[model samples]
Target: MSEASNPVVEGSLRERAARRLPSHTFSDLLVPVSSALDLAEGHAAGHAQRVTYIATSLGIALGLDAPTQLACNYAGLMHDIGVVPAGAGLGAYTRGDERMVFASLPLLSPEEAAVGASDSPEIVIERIVDHVIHGARTAREFGLPAETIKGISAHHEHWDGTGYPHGLKGEDIPILGRIICLADHIESMIDQAGPLLGRRNLPLWLNQLSGIEADPNLVSVLRDLASGDQFWLGLFSADLPGEISLGCSRLREPKGMRLLGFSESLSQLVDSRFSFTVGVSARVARYSEALGRAVSLPDLRLKQLRIAALLHDLGQVSVSERIMAKPGILSVEELEVLRNHPAYSRDVVAGIYGLEEVADWVAAHHERMDGRGYPDGRAGNEIPFEARILAVADAYVAMTSDRPHRPRADDADAQQRLRGAAGSQLDGDLVEIFLRQVVS
Candidate 1:
């Protein structure tokens, strides 16, 4: 598209500078355009877009100056840029994911990166939040402004003075940060549950939260909007695009391969992080990658799939080393624990960053095609392709490799079992693809 056709906000600040400002004026471009790009990690994937949207709304609502509004707009978009994802099984999820979206993405330069360089007091707090808080000092590595850093660092402080990391009381919170706290929480609750209260009395629900989790004034504003038909119409119009998300499939295949390698590394780390029954993790990692590639699955997808495959059996780690190491049949409790691991893995993975997108697949690896699977008993399309592939690979590897609980089944026996289970216990097409490769 031509320059005139471009949305003014869409282009890099540097590019926009050349067209709209004096050609050689470097002062206007405070930060490099590339750094801005680095500030958002896969922006389309999560709430960062909505957070920016609402923060803009809040800026307009507060009637801030153009410069401050523009700064807030960019800062809000990148506020959570320092989240360091350690994925489920070894970590947990929180409102922090919003912070990390901007915090953790690789930046263009260390010296001037938004997460770097702060010889100032304002930078001191920002440094504490982004790095010491998450284990990576992004604000120090990037030259983020003090005000911008302070706004993000304090976005979580409560109006009631009970907030974390710093017990800053109400009004003590920076205006921009307080507004962000307002916007972030409002968006979070709606996203977690439905925007509207479930079949209950609407006023009762909105009324209950007014003084509790939500700020009263903000709630009042929302209340007015919710009570009116025009607001409802506006909301309905906003959602007309149908919010089903789109993943970047253009490089998904290649990225999946890279992730496959990363998953192998991760799996190896996990295996080493705790005790393990055998050294079969390498084999598992390799074949999962092979299986994914064999099916024409992209590497990014395969990486997610490989993560599932690597960690799916981790719940078995909890089943008592004695039971896991025992050659005999397990007791009822042991069997129940074993049965629950598929779901347990999901919970474990959901807490970690970089792993949010893959948790369900890991959780659903044992689900049968006929919906007879454990955990949530999901089936068909509900069972992601990653789970399907991992299930087949797990079965193949488990059947052919000796487990502490059982001896290995031969290749022939494993093949027969897979073939027999197709369309019932296993995804038929996946099994077919797997066997075809193994046989040939």
Candidate 2:
């Protein structure tokens, strides 16, 4: 049997992860996504909760057949499952999506790379707009219902019929799908305004969205829900179990974050202790944001891409200065070791459950679409969008940054080379965007 399918003995990694994370439930999914969205962008900070309320309210208004409403509620809360730091200020995943995708690769195993590579990246990316591409089937593996799958799958579709996959419209859209779509959009808008923001003028905003992208009927119910004095009072009310329980979440999430954080930190600690590597860890996080923004992406997505771009070099963090500073190309063995660093980076982050998404991209920093890249030589679609975006960032950062053997490339020259590598190694879209930023 392939190693990817093979079960390995769980030891340090699985043991600690199990100890920290909670058992899976429809509820556990809500917390992490809410937290990450808050971290990313806070426009409508309670996007999840509001989505829940709006969706269920619409469900009640339409008399959603049965279990479908339940599915809508659950799917709306946890739809953006793969995003890391799922919090406010995420900036609608503008730039750093590529970066986040980059960070996710290394987290995949050789087996995963093979699986990702098994399907052509072009084919997979084509499916990205459709429900089948991103997490539809994977969600099914987790045992979600057909309605939930349909709701989540079509969440990205628009009412004007301009959305991806099969463009269903108006009443043609599944009732659950329509409810989720409106709930997610309104909730995100609410997050931008504080709890009071929604109170001040949410009715106007709800009215504005009617028939544009959201279902008109669903929008009206949302207006009705907000028209009450109890809208914010009900959601933020002290008695609600979700918010009340989140009081101590900050301290709790770190336990998961640390699992991944330590992998990077551990290498630095080891390197510093042995005096092997050349750079510092804290220094990387603060500076990498600029490097990440060097490419064109949304501000929210850029934040993560920068961190991953900063940490993309983390594999080299613990290498000996001798090896790091070596003048010429290295022996085959040295190159092999260099490739393993991506896996090292991923292993570090994988310990943190929240970072599992990030780890997958980070672990494959060196992989290529042509199947020639290393650590695992995962080609094409085997790599994720975040990883693909990150691969470009890594190249951009490495080329521009000063290295032991070579001085940084001139800005003009570096930009040209970045554009040239698109598709062969880096994503053409990312390369084009990065160049535009440089030119701008």
Candidate 3:
């Protein structure tokens, strides 16, 4: 174990560690990330995947090439991504009613504006319009082609210039956008369907929407496609992610920094799940990875820590907006939902292949050394070392960030609180390394 004697052996070990690390592709991350988005609405499980299938199917029917079809699918999968950051006040966007449609008239209520500066209709609409724009930006950031970005951003644009953002009309709308907009509309209608109004009224609904919401030509195609049993069967199919993969020939497999970049983008989306937690995960990722490096963790473990930190708060998507945005202390009942977020994060990450170790770290990010933490309370060494690093990183970032409940802690105060919790709450040695080396 002598330092001089171990140099060669340690270098070899690091090389092996680097080689042994697994690279996650875009599909692996996108599937679960989209699943996280779907969890924001209790009734909307698999919503994105279903829409992808429908939209892509229409893309094929419309004679789009393979790349364009894949763009349609990508747009369908990511159409709601803007919901993460603006989740609190996006009820108007999700309703799919005429009243909620984008128009020039004042949409904000006096009461809604009183909630917070960010809750105003003007702000929410800006955010809602920005959803499509944000989706396009995210698609581009993830290395999706320009077609994908255009399709996703224009998915809300209408034929008569009644849509959002650019308000393109008729042929001015991108074909990919038109297809996804129709698919999105159909999906919403089906989601709202129930005992009173079943699938039988779907045609009537389409008929009602022909000239206003979309092009009459596109509506005719959808109407024709709706008559086929195969469309319905495909719409409700269980293997949506698989189906999308089969259609998307251009999705490159992301590795190394590219993979990490995707995780960072996803972290931003996860932060969007609640307005208060914006940028929280990205900061944790930076701090945790830095601390992991400072502690001389293996290359593979550092990568795991970075990914875990990026997605640590993913479970919060399942919690209600009211609970997430509550300015006061959480009710005992609300705390129950909030407490399950870590477990939810664990489960979401675990479902994706090659990230089992990262999932464990994400699940344990809230666990305390003294066993007073949430989801699971394993104390001390029972928690993984990387999880301990995440705990410290998460604590420091959360404390330093401004929240609705309280003002942000200044650097000096945040350090004192983090230092005070070294042994019983966080790993004492990691905290010291973080304090002395990383942040300092």
Candidate 4:
């Protein structure tokens, strides 16, 4: 099927490309982005959603006010936002060693995994600290409330003061953090065991961890909630995303340029996974915006294009750092794995309410005018105009930036490549405008 005619590409360009598009609150956008983080961590699809639901439910049970409850929800969704950069620093470890480090740390008891331990232990501890600090900073950049920031920063802190990031004991940890900490662990447990088995063991597990890994009082609240079957059922429900949206319905939605800031922050997280690709998304967004304007795209279309550009590689998180950072050419198997990122990006973006069209554009950004591109091979007019412009912009930025396999191209050389690939690999018209209006 042609790209435009694909059943997945709903709404006309005129409707989807309106100047403002549909308004989406922070919850609407971040909920889907949270799934992308789940993919990065090798967790189940709804890990963040389940955590959010559990945390928000606990906050309500604890009688937290609306703002605090909202903070709990937001913290749950983004608690691990720092994991990408934290894992990025583990470049010295082989893929197996990296897995061992992450897998082993979780099994450590609070006292055994203290932050300043020697040798390999210290590396994991420091990375934990880096993760929380970076996550908190990203939350602040998104304009989330201070409570939400604190919750994200301190979620690892145990009640006994043994956690890596801060070692806060008892009531010292932010209440939101305590709630998220309990919820995060519980979700992980449930994920490891299916909900049915997880439900049977949850109470015993909570009692054991009380006053050690979790706040004892929060543990009591969770026990009370877990007594009812509905809690467990809702947690593992197929529609957990819907439940999360309902739970956070009260939080105020961020509007206007704030959305831009959120997208940029997410882009940074995606880029942080590899050293060579650090700011590639931001540059792609800029180039795409310039090309959009050059082609007289409406302001709304420009906004969508910029967001798609920023998030075009959201699926890159699913690729391992070992593969992404490989200095040599990839084998056929590795190349196939890398090529799936666009489809991954599309799935994540499509989950957001107002970004359906943006998702389609992102999916098609790698497509070729002559139908040689992947994930979908729509040629010529079958490709969305925005995707075509994005193709040229992405190509130009990628050519000019260093990659794992190649040094960056000089401007003249990069422009020549663009000229050579025009019509075959990229839209010819968009490529010319990019070279003249953007590069010049």
lDDT of each: 0.52, 0.53, 0.74, 0.81
For model 4, the stretches where C-alpha displacement exceeds 4 angstroms are 1-18, 95-121, 251-257
> Per-candidate TM vs. native?
0.41, 0.42, 0.80, 0.89
Tens digits of lDDT, candidate 2, 259-290:
22323433233233122233443344433344
What is candidate 1's TM-score against the reference? 0.41
- Model 3 vs. true fold: TM: 0.80
Specify the highest-TM-score model's number: 4
Q: After superposition, how far is residue 160 of candidate 1 from its true place, in Å?
A: 44
Per-residue lDDT of candidate 4, residues 19-87 (tens digit):
566766668877888888777766656778888989987988889887888788889999888777787
Rank the models by lDDT, top first: 4, 3, 2, 1
Candidate 3: tens digits of C-alpha lDDT, residues 1-440: 88647988889877886756465555566666677767764435677787788787777778887666656766777776655554454643333221132211112222243233333446455665665676676677778768877887787787778887798988889888888787877777776675235368878988877887777887888788878788877777777776666556354433443666777877776676555677888889999989988888877778878889998888887876666766799999999889999998887788677788889989998889999988888899999888999999999998999887899999899999999999999999988999999888
Every model: Cα RMSD to truth: 15.1, 19.2, 6.5, 6.5
Location of the lowest summed lDDT over 10 successive residues in candidate 3: 97-106
**Model 4: pairs clashing at backbone N, Cα or C within 3 Å:** 19-300
| TM-score comparison, 2 vs 3, better candidate | 3
Q: Give the candidate order by descending TM-score.
A: 4, 3, 2, 1
Point out the worst 10-residue segment of candidate 2 by lDDT: 84-93
